[model samples]
Target: MTLNYYPDKPNSESDTAIYLFLRIGKETIKIKTGQYINPKHWNTKPDKNGNHVKRSYTGSPEFNVWLDNYKKDIHQLYNKLTQGNVAISVKELREAINSHLKKKEPTAVIGFFEHFLDYIQITSGERSKSTITKYKVLYKHLETFSRDQPYKLSFEAIDMRFFDLFKNYLMQQLKHTDNTLWKDFSILKTFMGWALDRGLHQNLTYKKFKAPQKDIEIIYLTEKELMAFYHAALPLGSKLDKVRDVFCFGCFTGQRYSDIANLKRNDIKGDRWTLRTVKTDKSYFVPLNRFAQAILNKYKDALRPLPVMSNQKTNDYLKELGKLLGIDEPTSLTKRRGNEKLTNTQPKFEFISTHTARRTFITLSLEKGMRPEVVMRISGHSNYSTFKKYIKISEKVAEVEMNNIWQMAEPKQEENQ
Candidate 1:
């Protein structure tokens, strides 16, 4: 393969430059040292130190297996790149190339993974926090999926059938949501495009991936439902209160579950609270509301410099609590599914979840006529569209609010004793 242009480090602070390279096999073509940008990705809150935090998807033990496979693929790719073991003869580079390298010469199928990892580490840092998280999620699948489908395979071996099945595998077999399916696809498209644009592939690009659908409802809890959730009885104890308080904290602050898991004492202040949002790096502050303050005060004895609840425990307990709340109903039927189904029906829970806290907080605030911009301050959302999406006011609430706009001048008379 030929190096069209030698990519370099972004600035003096870096020693290596990320470059792009390509390899052509007898029947298979390979693209190495490439990276792509995701157009759509959801991110988690940053750690107190302002580092990106990992995210968890909703669902169950089944999803755990999927996530594991995805991570394994990334690790494989990471090791091959950083350690320079992508091909038998591809030794470690003496210097690092911090940018994408353009390929013009016919090269051998080696060092593909190594070159790819260098790209991963470099681009991962520059992308938005959300996009970075997305890369992590999508790459995991790429890693695992590529395990069975090695890089040396012919381009013709991959077709719309494979791409289509992979889409189904992500949504149906892997139990991803409609939104998650598209998100992974979007991320994959960018990465795949990096290879295609650099002349890595003989004949393949991201445009080939098909979308499943686009009609998932923005479901969230109601104000009355939220009140019931907050006031509902749970087994009385400190440990349980910790989870409950954390969930309530999400309701009050609208921070993500991952962000809530990393909360520390110093992040709080007297009479006010502030933090840059996890998903988007936008900063915002709000006068600590009464409910939020009370939860903090109650947890004072057990407070640490980090967030209150462990994500693993909180998520598990949330499922239990959801069932207790009667919001999630039990599903008893099991049907045959291949490696391409979008979701496998699992037992449902009664109440909502930590995510619901965020959606409900924003939705209820909207119902009370809170301005979108002001509500964003508390929720830490950077834009109006995202804030609007989480606001789940039902038709009934809108009708009631609408009725208050007009009325007859005269009122019916009532007798007084």
Candidate 2:
């Protein structure tokens, strides 16, 4: 195939739009490159009119590079289309060229998984970076799963059968937890929905595929336990001491680890703390309790409430702190995969991380008589289902709260008298 450009009209003015001509098999197709330049700067190898222009006047080097890249893109598309002796036509070529030119980064005819990753990249600025990272990780998992599949990964291939096979692979081959599998499939489903909305793929079998999730036991520190952890003395000037301060701050303020680690003095407004959440851009206002206030008072001379540390390092220190505080109670985790029920038990401290702080806040808030909606507002939770998940109410606590409710319903002693 050959690519060339010419003026829109034979006697067009100096500033006329240039259009592309593609010659294939037996047909020549016209494509509008949307590039306008002076006719005097036009270039034609051979033509009837003596307008045999060679170079453009407006920055020839840049224009030449752009033209060369455009031609290279078309040629690459042509080569990709001709692979496997596939039938090719001028209309298909034009459409392919159009698709290539429209992309922010042209690579090839993208498959399902690749296009999902591309979407993530293209909208990187609009979405949270961590969210994009999760999507990329999901893509990697999909790519690995596709390697062993009978067919290439495409939208049409993501039917119910493929869902079952993929779920089995994640369970038997990858050994993913029920929660992990559910989250991964959720991302996949989101991408598939996006593809459908954009009219990229027609097969909607994924819409009917159920992404099952078992109730995960949320492990968190109770009110007394949080106070115990708070007042627990650590070695002076130790990393554990610093991490404990930040972890307690998170528990009190209900901020995420990312937000806590990056919290600045400016974000703290007197007794009320205000800052936008990192995962979601929503802002929250949480009143600092005496415990959180005491920690900040301890570091009054510092720029922030606590010194920042890497999340991984903080978790590592937290484990040591938990062990120091004797938080080694036996805890069990159970999850269901297909016909198998998997269970694991270990010390609670082994599972404690920065996330426990937020969970502690929500659970303790509800335990302390805060309404679910109020706690949700403080925690920046948008939905009741998600808010309820973070609250770990024991049967004993439930009974006590219910009894209190009954007591409130009782008539006053003076009125009975």
Candidate 3:
């Protein structure tokens, strides 16, 4: 293609020039009579001086209408010059517009994170609702951290360095633990797996960012202490320890929070509470222990409105109540796990989580020399390793029985005094 031009300005000295023109090999077009307009007219604005100074129109609504008309004129001029020959598709127009917009900004990738979020929602149908909520928070943090990067770190596109930095942020900045950091990493890894399956960009730093061994210490109150904790908590009313009750209920019946929270009045029949857990989809026929039933009765009004303790409020409040009961410290409780750090200011119990209830059930039952298989069924553990992990060797139980069999070998009491 070639172009010929007629230079025109209102103050021009030449009147012999026509309009600018273009030509292809055998085809040619000319615009000799059309109006000549300023090139900067597409991107103009008025100055404060109120002068009709040269201006350009931005791609705003007002200017967009004008740009389309101008483009039509150009296309017509070209075809009129080339005899209706240069056919362009819609794709070409889109590309041209995109190129124009991109040039207005730096070469950095824009809205990459936005696109990444859309990709995650579209592809990862396997993610839990809790996970999606967490992803939103993670995405917000990533957006702040990646302000200088070309692309926003995405859920699935994050590298091992991203994980490393994120874990550091959670630990050093947020003061979360190894287990807490692991939860974040696990979600990220799951998202990466989703991304990998969908052929998205893979991270190079996953192995390096991974935390080691991912072990957590599960702890709970002893049966004696649990009773004390509950009796102490009895005065708190609806502000009661539903977690403790639910946990104790879980300890006795082996149901998880997912199943426990969804339990309904209809779930009970002939003193047995039956529920199918949402997480594992396992149905449990728990013969409601008297302690568990007492929890249900105490919280009938509070729990009638909702099934599980959905807020962290009850857990926090229960910790306060536990302190009054002397089961406040981790070491003060017999069935409690040894890995927990005890608080001094007793700023309240922090080590107690929902899992403590499950562990307590397994610990107590195993301490009583209950069969592992029976414990597994009650606790709903599908594996022996998991059941064994919670089967704590009760030092008190061993010490209490230390001289019983040996003393029997020596002799028996001849008379009752």
Candidate 4:
């Protein structure tokens, strides 16, 4: 077996990563040492004592010591694995070395909630603010469930029994619908998987925990309703007018409330607006239609391209605006809590929210003959499963429109006859 260390980027002036190269028989493996140094400070060749880095440079002594110890650890690990007389490949050897090198610091014994907080802290940089907020919300729900039932929450305690208990608590006590419960359980499973990867516990019971989700009704404005709402007059310079414009901007551009709120004047170029979506962080180039462009021109002299409000305020005002414009078609929504199915019917205007704008854009776009792929591109939807819901809504709208067209055509044929 031969082992050597080399800079990842030998020609680079900036700091570069170092990698350990190992060759045993016909098997060769390269692994990152998780150390970085400038190319000038890194030695490509070993000296008389077979040391790649000399102790002359700053921090070189400590770095060399770590390298020496790392090599020794790898050799000792290989011998230990071979002494069992079991065939071991480079993959197994590499994994053992990685575990040894990247051993997590010993954490104090803590409850599940405390460990969850630590997980949030450590992974905050990797997750979006909204995602972290959702995780925190789930944490609160779990805390409440634990306190109410007096059940000890720990990694080892997460089993089929805990799943059943928590599932019942979410449905019976919290009255969460199937969809909401599914989302919460999904986040819980993600957290469990993360904890498991860190060697927190070997419990795999969460893998069997299932929370089925049901498709709830998606509400959006029809083309005629959207046009009427777009042209609805409000008091000039009023909050409602601003909210209408911002909401319509989202409807026209197929963007979320967060993205629309964060839209900048610099993001617009000609008739197109290119910006990264706040939720997914995916860049989308949305072409501005006549209506969308008009809204932009209306707010040309304003601080922002459009007068954007907080998501909550915008959603509140959208319902009010929808009601004012007489967009009051009745809509019904059905949801499930455990085995009980509950249905609620209300004026469609009452259901209008910031999210409705994007749905309206997608539904109307599909109904008006835009292909699903094109709509998905503008909406930044990579998953067909989620986008399929909008397609189903559009198909229903098309059926209704086709019936109307056929009814009108029958009268025209009779008149011609």
Q: Which candidate is the best by TM-score?
A: 4
Error of 3 at 174 (Å): 3.8
Give the CA lDDT, 0 to 100, for residue 224 in model 2: 73
lDDT of 4 by residue, 1-417 (tens): 788898998998766798888889888889777777767766688777666665544445557888888778777777888897878877888898778767843455676898899988887877778889989999999898775564557788898878998999988888899999999999999999999998998999999989978876898887888888788878878999999888888899888888887889999999999988766777869899999999999989988898887888988988888888888888898898878989989999889998998999998899889999999999889999989998888788888888988886446445554
Minimal lDDT window, size 10, model 2: 49-58
lDDT values of the candidates?
A: 0.55, 0.77, 0.56, 0.84
Q: On a 0 to 1 TM-score scale, where does candidate 3 land against the true structure?
A: 0.55
Q: How many residue pairs clash in each candidate at the backbone level? A: 38, 1, 10, 0
lDDT of 1 by residue, 262-371 (tens): 56677789767666555555566656678888778866776463246656677677667666676654433222233333434444442355676777677777777888
Q: How close is candidate 1 to the true structure, as a TM-score?
A: 0.55
TM-score of 2: 0.68
TM-scores of the candidates in the order shown: 0.55, 0.68, 0.55, 0.70
Best by lDDT: 4
Which prediction has more favorable lDDT, 3 or 4? 4
Q: What shift in Å separates residue 113 of candidate 4 from its native position after superposition?
A: 1.7
Error at 90, model 3, angstroms? 27
